[model samples]
Target: MRRKLAAGNWKMNGLVDDLSEIKALTEAHPDPDVDMLICAPATLIAQMAWARGTHALQIGGQTCHAERSGAHTGDISAPMLRDAGASHVLVGHSERRTDHGETDADVAGQAAAAHAAGLVAVICIGETLDQRESGHALTVITDQLRGSLPPGATAANTVIAYEPVWAIGTGKVPTTEQIGEVHGTLRATLRDLMKQAEGVRLLYGGSVKGSNAGEIFAVADVDGALVGGASLKAADFSPIVSALENA
Candidate 1:
C-alpha cells in the first residue's frame, strides 16, 4: 500500500515569522500516522526546516532548476534545496508552466535533477477549464505524465499531483467523481509506464480543504492532497491531515 502524503505548497508565500505555523502543525500531530510536508518559498526553506526541529514535518522547495548548478541567474538548484534540508521539490506546478512557459521536457529535466540530489520530485499535471469542458482532460493529463516524467523516475522518488487549473484558489473543486476518474486514469497510465507504478502516490490538488478533504480522500487511488491556500495555517490544515489518516 502506498503511504499517504499531505503535502502543502506555500507557493510564493511565507517568511521567517510564518515558520510558527509549521511548528504548530508538528505540535498538533507530533506522531502523525501519515506524512506531512510543506513546500515553502525558496527564502524560507532552510528556516522552516530548522523550525520543524525533531518533528516529522518535512520541508521542501516550491521549484528547482533543472541543472544541479549553472550560470542561470535567479534559479535555485535541486542540490541547493537538499543542502538546505529539503527532502522534496515540486516540479512543473501550473503557475510555473503558465508564468514561465515551462514545457513538459523542462519538467522532466527538473525531476531528473531532483532525483540526482536525492530528493523526491512531486511532478504536477493538470488540465485547464476549457480542456475539461471539451472532454479532453484525461488525454491532456496523461500526455503530461508521458512527457514530463523523467527517464529514471520510480515510486520511491516520484509523486504525481493533479490540480485542475480552474479549481486552484478559485473556491471550486472537481466533484468526487471527476477526481476519481482522473486519479484512476493516472494510476493506469503510471502502471503502463513504470514497474513501480502501484507504489507511487497520486495526490489531488486544487481547492482542497478540511471540509472537502474527507470526501476527496475517499476516492480510489487518491493517496492524499497537494494543498495550497488552506495549508498556510495549522487550524485549517490539521483537519485535512486527520481526514487522510482516517481515510
Candidate 2:
C-alpha cells in the first residue's frame, strides 16, 4: 500500500517562540497516520528534534550542501543535518534553483550527499507560469525529472514533489485533471527509470491547503503533498494532514 504524506515547508519562517505551534500539533494529533513532517529553517532543527515524540512528527532540513565538508562558507551538509536531527532534506526547491542558481547536476549531487549521510532526499521539480502558458510545462518538468534525480534513488531514501512554480504561494493550483496528467507521466517515468521498483511516492505541492488537498490527493499517482504557506499554522495544516487519513 502506498503511504500518504503531508509535509510542511516552513521555509525561512519560524522562531523559538513558534515552537508552540508545533507543541499544539503534536498534542492535538498524537500518532498521525499520514506520514507527517516539517521542514524548518536550519537554525531550529535541534530544538524541534528535542521536542519530537512518538507522534511521528518527523523533522527535515530546508536544504543541504552537496559537499560533505568544503570551503563553501554558507553551506550546511547532509551529515550536518543528520547530526542536527534531520531525517530528511529537501533538494531543488524552486527558491534554491532561482535564488542560488542551482542546476540539475547540483541537485543530483545534493541528493547523492543526502543518501550518503542516510537521509531521505525530497527532490522538488516544477515549471514556471510562462512554460505552462506556452504549453511547455510538461516538457520542462520532465526534463528536470530526467536530469535532477540521481542513480540509486529508491523509494526508501527518496521522494519526488511536483510544485508548479506559477502556483506556489500564489493561491493558484493546476486543475485536478492537469495534476493527474503530470503525476501519471511522472509515475511512468520513475517506474521506467527504476526498472519497476515500487514504493516511490509522488507528492503534489504548490499552494496546497486543507481546502484543496482532498481533491489533489484524489488524483491518480498523487500519494501526498508538500504544503507551503498553510503549513505555517497548525490549524490550517492539521486538517490537510487529516485529509490524508481518509484520502
How many steric clashes between backbone atoms does each model show?
A: 0, 0
TM-score of 2: 0.98
Residues 1-247, candidate 1: write the lDDT tens digits.
8999999999988878888898789989999999998999989988888898899888889899988897999999999999999999999999999999999999999999999999999999999999999999999999999999988999999999999999999999999999999999999999889999999999999999998999999999999999999999999999999999999
lDDT of 1 at 242: 97
lDDT of each: 0.95, 0.90
Residue-wise lDDT of candidate 2 within 133-232, one digit each (tens)?
9999888888898888889888899999999999999999999999998998888788778863468889999989888888988898899999988988
Global lDDT of model 2: 0.90
How does each model score on TM-score?
A: 0.99, 0.98
Q: Candidate 1, which ten residues in sequence have the lowest lDDT sum?
A: 14-23
RMSD of each: 0.6, 1.0
Model 2 off-target regions past 4 Å?
Answer: none
